[model samples]
Target: MDSYYFDEKSKFDARDPLGILYKITFRLIQIKVIKMALIFTFFVHLIMNCLHFFEILSTFDADLLVKYGPTLFPLVYGLATIIFDLMFEKKTAIVLEETFSQMWSLDSTGSKTAKKIKKESKILIGLVVIDTILATVAIMFYLPIMEWDIDIYYAIRLFEMKFSPTMSLVFSILYYATIPVLFFSMLCTTFALFYIMSYEKFQTYAINDLLKNISIDYQKIDDWKMMRDQSYQNTMYKRLTICIQRHQLLKRMEVNINQIIFTPI
Candidate 1:
């Protein structure tokens, strides 16, 4: 009885449940990141639209400013989130799983394709840095803008400019409170993105190893088959040779017996 599990081939390490959970959590985070990114983008767009409606941001090429403020940031965030998900969650995950199974084999010839994917991490990292900087700048400007007393600045103050100090204080407090939550949400998104990108490296390595493993397994099977065929052929040849030699000897014996019986008498 073979105790080894031939059918399953590889057994995942039982001690790595935490790691597995972590990976799964990261994937879920990816999903949430996209959702939150869209939500934040919508909020920004709404703010921009409101500013435009109030003519607060209408002085400088209204169309272009609106396009940039309300449209561009959201567009960029949504697109980046989508692209990241496509790469990590969809393509990279499949490739990694397959690669993992392959690498589980002891023998492998490694692939370079995965290496190419890993080399793009620099680009991903660069994007992350740029986005972070942009987000920071946006938030910095947004905070002052939201808090500013436009009535005082423009002096065209509407009569009903009942800027409630209490409301302002309340909003300020709420903003501070939500800032942490927002930061946490963004942190989760960032971490998720980083993990996915990082896992890409692992995936590439795993895949290359898997290719090697499959190659080795196939070669081994082919070699065994060739040896088996040669062995069968050798056995058959030897048996045929013995049969032929025995037949020849029997014929010779029959001839001798006939010759003896026909003696010159």
Candidate 2:
């Protein structure tokens, strides 16, 4: 399971929940220069793409538009999403920390439940690995894995001066360099989705475990007389209240997270 801790100086810190993903996406927000540089890099890439695009946009046929629109749209959307996330990175971190702390506070209840959550954590982490591998594999299409890298075409008309064949090749290499970072920009959206979705998954697992334990404990009461006892009633009430409070906490977390991510709650 991923761990988090509150530092005296910092509100919260991930113990590599998604392998520096939190660091890259959220922690970097505190470093204004680095965050601005990331945005600036994407902006430069977008501008170059736009210029190159409009240059031949008049000559664009259905085939050209069909090929270009898919790529262009995602770039714009991904950048917008990343920017929005950075804007709310602090709130996101705080909510996430509070969620984790609350959940972990209940860790003493059941060893069985803890074991189950541990197993689930592995699966979720594996999913993240699979996604990262697939994202990296996607770079093969843009990088020079083949003689005709699509990014070579993207970098070709980036400047007003007509590039010699050799210069175009050089520009393409430079463009290829930017693809990892830009593609990472795109993947940040995916990472955000994964993190939010995983929270809900863990919430389900934890709540089910708690409720199941409550059921088993209730069934184990060998004395019907105990049910009528005031002390026993108070104990049961406390357990029921705990269950209700757990559900309410998770629900609020869900809504707050959705609001921050602009997801429909």
Candidate 3:
């Protein structure tokens, strides 16, 4: 890897405090909170669904199970995908962080193309923030209607079973709380994965462009080197070799990203 691509300080450093906060918030939401929510919600949903399953079994009501099964199926599949993504999230995060860092460091050369890469990076980051907020808001609005219109019906059915009033209230409370978390976590996981993939794709495109620029520079150096001293030509050749190596490294990174990150999606 190029030393320029590996610089840690360039990863999330921003000029404005808000930009810094956005980076912090993005990491927290994507890497930490989202995982925590997924695990928490998964178990909670499992417990709640088990309770419902038992209720159906006890009642021997095949129709009830049939009614709720379709609705529950998608949530189950979505959460499973979220769990699968969590398994490889650490590796994906490392690749994504390096890609993000390289975008910023590319601008350190002070070239117009580098500046353009940096600008596009900032725009992508902004889109991530917006996507997260929009997903959150949509979940908030959608969950209440879902719970009231659908979940409450199932809860009412489950409540009819013989049980103490206190236990009934407890089940109701748990059911309401877990349902929203389950839905919200699924949405967040989807958006976070999307943001990571989008960043990877953008970085790959920028790196390709950088490699093209480097190739042009190498050609210019070759044209100039014919008139130069032997030692100067040797130095230019070494630099050209480094550029070729950097291009190959970036191509490998893209392939690794697709295999490790995009494959899970």
Evaluate all candidate structures by whole-model CA lDDT and list the values in order.
Answer: 0.42, 0.60, 0.55
Backbone clashes in model 3, listed as residue pairs? none
The C-alpha TM-scores of every prediction are: 0.37, 0.71, 0.61
Tell me the TM-score of model 3. Answer: 0.61
* Top candidate by TM-score: 2
How would you encode candidate 3's per-residue C-alpha lDDT over 29-141 as one tens digit per residue? 46665667667767766665677778788989887777777656765665675565566555655765664454434433325545565676577667766866876775565
- What's the lDDT for residue 91 in model 2? 81
Prediction RMSDs, each to the true structure? 24.6, 5.8, 5.9
Residue lDDT tens for model 2, 35-115: 665666677677766775675677664554565565666556656665655566678777866766655332333666556
Off by over 4 Å in 2: 1-34, 52-67, 105-109, 144-152, 160-174, 215-223, 263-265
Least well predicted 10-residue stretch by lDDT in candidate 3: 1-10
Steric clash count of candidate 1: 3
Off by over 4 Å in 1: 1-49, 52-162, 213-265
Best by lDDT: 2
Model 2 CA RMSD to the hidden true structure, in angstroms = 5.8
- Clashing residue pairs in candidate 1 are 108-212, 108-213, 109-212
Window of ten residues with lowest summed lDDT in model 1: 151-160
